[model samples]
Target: MPKFAETIFQIMKKFFLSTTVLAIIACLLWATPFTAIKIGLKYTTPLQFAGLRFFLSGLIILPFIKDFRVKVKEASKRWRFVLWVALLQTTFLYGLFYTGISYVPGALGAMLIGAQPLFAAIMAHIMLRNDKMSWQKVFAILLGLSGVCIISLGRADFVFTTTIPIGVGILLLNNIVGSTGNVIVSRDAKNMPPRVLASFSMIIGGAMLLLFSIPIEHPNWTAVHPGEYYISLGWLAMVSALAITIWFGLLGREGVKVSNLNTWKFIIPIFGACLSWLVLPNENPDTISLIGMFVIACSLLLVNFLNRRAQKAQVRLSSMASH
Candidate 1:
């Protein structure tokens, strides 16, 4: 290879292996399932499908865990915390998410899900003593909300007449529920093994969703599904298993800052919206929606910039104090 090309390859290799890049990969994996979920929902009811996906995801993680039975036994002592996470994170969050996605275009659904971090920041501000809201964070939240509003307005015709508004509301609620789950895990799961917690909570949550679906959705198990349906389900389960596992590993790594790692999630909407537009037959870019996406993307960038600046200032102050 030419010297210049070799140099570029080395740089790319290092970048790809970095913790930040791994987080981005996890987010990318997460972004993929929105499309798969939409496809699977076409052939099955949302609750039943979600239940199966999560159930399978939990099972998939079991084989990777060493001394799985011991871990599960230990984790069982914290059953209440596990159950709380199960209910809020898997069951409620995804139950609402799958149902809401059914009513919106895939691109729009991706954008709404991408707004999760904005809600998360607010939740952290309110719940965590050390994570108080800064002026920059407040401004970013407003900008993020404006982007969401713009996205909703882009669907003006369907907003009132169809179920679009209801779907949007449900999705926003899903973000809040997911954010609450994050806070709970951060505060309470300090001693819990993430793998065990992830596995059992998903299994329990999945079972609950299945039980709820039987009475509520009246799913038709006898009906034959297309190959695409199974494919979508399998992919979604794998995405859930792989992405969550990677994220947990990243979080446990030494010297990895959680906030800095999480900032990579900003790319989820970018990849998700683009993928939906490219793959979903019914989804295409609208000028207004694109503008909304750009605004949201900018808000994420601004927040990330602010966070980096704050971290650098803290480092400088600590050095000065030591001197």
Candidate 2:
């Protein structure tokens, strides 16, 4: 095959993978845990679930991908950024996520985290030299916030006020911190393979968190159940790590924002709400609650509008310079 044909084939492959993988990963990862967290509430405290998620995730995942291990002596020179990214990205981010999951429904937790795309666009707009923002972004942000409010509070005249505020605060922080991590990963890190990056994140983040967990953890060797741990552990690593790693790599190749070009993450709230309601029927998200979720869904769609405008600005500038 000619070089041009090979290049086109590679590009197409990456595009197909990125578009499908990220969304696919998003669905299962979000749904399973939303259910698991509900179950975990029956068995253990939120922090236990949080601690176990990372510790077990690391132990189960590390043996498979040995390539991510950095040499101790040289890491200071070359892989220094990994430490920073891991701490912020995995350490604090997942810690907050699992803790937040304990207090809220899984679907709600995922949508809150998924909202980072909006935050990401702002970071990308400011940090990337070529990606400029327009009025569409401002309107989108405002509309998106409106949607978020509706999801959080709306009910059949029964607002979800006063109860889950802490959960919201935790998820909100996770979104911001995770967005900051994304910007750092995009801007500072070397262009490494995605699997390697994921492995590094899991290892470093898992280890650091373990250190904190060790002192507090009481060995319930008899009481602790392995069945649910295995289930959540397997799904999170395979779906959230391997799949998401592939998705991020595709984003780098196919434009980090291209997923937004389609009706991408706006569906997060839909899947989240439906799955949350279905999977955890005990929580019982009513019609008003569903409508509130619809508002969040619409806001996420509006966030994509910002994505489109940024792309248009790039096109117009390119056309002008061509003259």
Candidate 3:
């Protein structure tokens, strides 16, 4: 093969592979959780279900890692950050997530979680000096917020009554907590092995949830059906193990910003909505909700494109200076 043609073929091949990997990871992280969480809720209280799932998720990966004890001691020295991550990411985030999903449709619940990237961008802009929010990002943030609002109002006659507001509030809180956790993880958790960090933080957070759940939720251990219990455990564990490790790895990767990677997460709702429609037919979103999804998608694309272009321009300027 000619050298130029060979180069073109290699570039195409790399693009295809990378695209395929990203799609698979995105689906796993976003799509499967909606259906899985809905199914899991049928057999257990929200807190107990979330607690056990995450604890086991961490435990599942603990065995594969070597010298984690030494790492644990290192982590202990930075216990404040580690515990803070546990509290924000696992404890507060999943506690609200499990509870909110119980009160809303799977698709709506997932869409609310989809707004997390907006929160992540805003948080990164505030916290990370290098990731300051540009005018384009600020506009994108507003657009994304509007999309979420559209979805929320579309569900009812704009009446904030009963469980609707509570569910929405909880899901929104989940986004804030989860986004804060992302920023912290990017800042602090990058030093540890990604798997070790994922495992320990999950266990810490899950333990807190379980301790609170026993007294508050008062879950009857025997009441859960064996099949439902196992299935929920299995699905949640897989998500925790796979999605989270990949997430931490991505965050720690060189040149990856919390905002840049998170912008891609806006598509979660689209994937989640489709999956919910297929698996939980009753949770199908209406016309207005679909329109909201489209708006969010556009906002995400705009933010990501602008950010990438800015990064490339900065690189070119850096190259010119070196010359």
Candidate 4:
């Protein structure tokens, strides 16, 4: 029995590591959106973009499912977790985040919204005894923040101005909601299969966004920028919508913020500072940007390691006590 339990643990550990890697790649992939949003802003209002992105992303996801005709109406009825997920992650968070981008720079706005992970880390520690805060995790949080400071000090391109305070405020609200949603997901939605949870959330969220978009039809096709049109659309669909949907599913089960902290381990400040080049072609990411990214990555890795080691130790202690 002990051997079998250990084997299962080992398998789960490996699976988590792989999923963590994929999740990180997805996080980095999302870095491009900072630039894409700048381009997207050139054509559409923030509300318009938010509504369109959700609608388009949801549409893209629907065709890919194997059993599109099949419906599991009972899942949400059986589990109230889906309702909270729909309201927090898809409906409010993205709506505010996408809209906020209209008021702030995409890259900079993305960085500010990073408060989500900070909230995630703290919430995970408080909410889950298994994911207690450790010195190493503290170091990781500090390191990640330090990287952001480095970028702020060096980059003349990103100015923290007053016009966008409202935008930033909205994002902070989004961050709070997003983080709480993650905690709920981690506690309640862990039992559901990842794909099912993800698909359901997206469908619910997309419906909400569409319902809201009707009143704000400022959509003028002539306003669209040819160069950024398809690229921006693709980014919202693949990265922001689909990628985030999968991540929300993962987070609901694994402390989305904590599980996601791995990706932020490096990409936030690095991409935050450097991505101006990809997202904003005229802007340049200096050495300071790269250094900031490196520091943040180191911090997150340290924290993640501490958390994992602590979890392992707790398990061992439990086994000994049982024996």
Candidate 5:
């Protein structure tokens, strides 16, 4: 190989192996699934599709888990906690998510879901005594909310017949439910194995969705789907499995700060929206929507910055006290 080519290859190898790069890759995987979900929903009802996707994701993770039966038994001890997480995180959240995404543009759905970290911060503040909100967090939340409002306004036609408003509202509610589930896990599931928690929650929650769909959606299970539908479903399931597994691995790595890793998630909306515009024929970029996305991105960055600063300040104070 030429010296220049060799040097570029070495750089790329190192970049691909780094934790930061892996985190970004996980975010990218997460971003792609919105477009896939939109495609899959075309062939089946929202809940039915989401159920199969998550159930498959759970099964995919099972083989990788060491001593799966033992871990499951341990998880069963906290079955209530696990069930709550399943209901809130996977079932209710994704149930609303699929329904909401069905009605909205894929870019809008991605942007709304990407705003979850802001809601998560609020949930943490409310639920954890140590995570009380500061002025910076308050400001970040307000800015994020404004961005959400802008994005909604940009998409709305102000007509009663349009489902855009309803879709946006459901997605916003989806974020709240998701944030609540995060807080519950953070506060209570400290001792549980992460993989086990994820696996069971997805499996159980997905089953609930499937059962619920029978009565509510009345889906035609016998109907055959095109190759495109199966392709979308497979991609979505793989994305969920890989993204969650990768994220959990990153969290376990030494010296990898959760806040820093989480910062990469800010790019999810940016990438997701761009991908939707690129891949989906009906979706296109608008100036207002772009502006809204930029605002939301800035808000997430501001919040993550403030959080890291606060963590550093606390570390310094603890050092001083110890000395």
Candidate 6:
């Protein structure tokens, strides 16, 4: 029995490397937003909820702003660039995201959100010379996206509606625009600290969202229970801060392609479904959703495996040349 237990432990340990483990944790954390959004929307309108979440997320990073200011001074004229980043990354990204989430189930929202990496791959290829797309990468991206389609179409509740398409389209647009922002930031390669960029961009974007929500939503504060409000905001803000920080940090990691980093985002929907099942009442996934999740996970594993093989081959070629 002891030997069997030891073998099981070793098998589990071999399955998850440190980076893969970290990525899974990050994906799980990131998956919370859809559920959180569902909870928060019980108290506030979508735009207002998004505004508050991102505003607080930005505020959480304020203690580190002194370095951001110094970086801004050196790159003074880039405030416009920063604003553009804020517009795409925060303002439109969550503006549309929150709005879209309202229309779809959390599980469906997760599937749509998982499509971001596909958009990111296309944007990265166009924007970064070094991150050119390969046939394998292209095929991997399609496989991942096909899983999203299966999830969407295979569900029994699926139906075509004007509102449903609009919601899905907005989410897709959010991914495209958000991916564009990522490529821009990567192309800049300013080596700006991720926390600082996150701080300023989120603040700017959140303010814009709040401004829009004021005229449109006029969200009533008295309607929200203080405990639930604080809890939702706290979770959303913390996850947003951490996810963005980790995402940008990974993007800046040497030899890590943005598309490669994003392919792991496929796990977000899988974890999202599991968590929603556990946390949100009436959110248990069905057979189709489970099958779709399996497809996406397999695609991610395949992409990463191919990437590692390619990287190893490149290293070998470099070593041969040096010798």
The TM-score, computed over Cα atoms with residue i paired to residue i, of candidate 5 is 0.79
RMSD of each: 4.3, 5.2, 4.0, 5.3, 4.7, 5.2
Lowest summed lDDT window (length 10), candidate 3: 152-161
- Residues 1-323, model 4: lDDT tens digits: 69999999999888865656667666766766656766776777665666566666756665565554443554655446766677786888878777776677645664676555676767777777655565566666666766766765566456666868888888878877777777777777766555556666766776777667667654564553686677877776777555665565556554344534433634655654555676656777668777876777677677667657766987999999999
* Model 3 C-alpha lDDT per residue in residues 1-323, reported as the tens digit of each score: 99999999999888854533554485457557656776777787789888888899889888877887887788778888778878997999989887776666644664587677778988898888877777888788678767766665665553334677788888988888898888888887768887878888899998999998999999877763758658767977977787787787777766678877776665665565666667764677689879988888788778768867987999999999999
Please provide, for model 5 over 211-256, each residue's C-alpha lDDT reduced to its tens digit, 9 standing for 90 to 100: 9999999999999999989999989888888886666556555444
Task: Write down the lDDT of every candidate, Cα atoms only.
Answer: 0.78, 0.59, 0.77, 0.65, 0.77, 0.78
- Model 5: residue 294 alpha-carbon error in angstroms: 4.4
Clashing pairs in 6: none
Each model's TM-score?
0.80, 0.70, 0.82, 0.78, 0.79, 0.84
lDDT of 6 by residue, 200-283 (tens): 788889989999998888877566476876798899998988777666655666677878778878777677668867986877
Task: Report how far off residue 299 is in candidate 4 (Å).
Answer: 0.3
Better of 4 and 6 by lDDT: 6
State which candidate, 1 or 3, has the greater lDDT: 1
Ranking by lDDT: 6, 1, 5, 3, 4, 2
Considering summed lDDT, which 10 consecutive residues are worst modelled in model 1? 254-263
Over 4 Å off, model 3: 1-24, 66-70, 100-111, 144-160, 163-169, 280-293
Give candidate 4 misplaced runs (Cα > 4 Å).
Answer: 1-17, 66-71, 76-80, 102-111, 126-129, 157-164, 214-227, 252-266, 271-285
TM-score winner between 1 and 4, please give it.
1
Question: Top TM-score: which candidate number?
Answer: 6
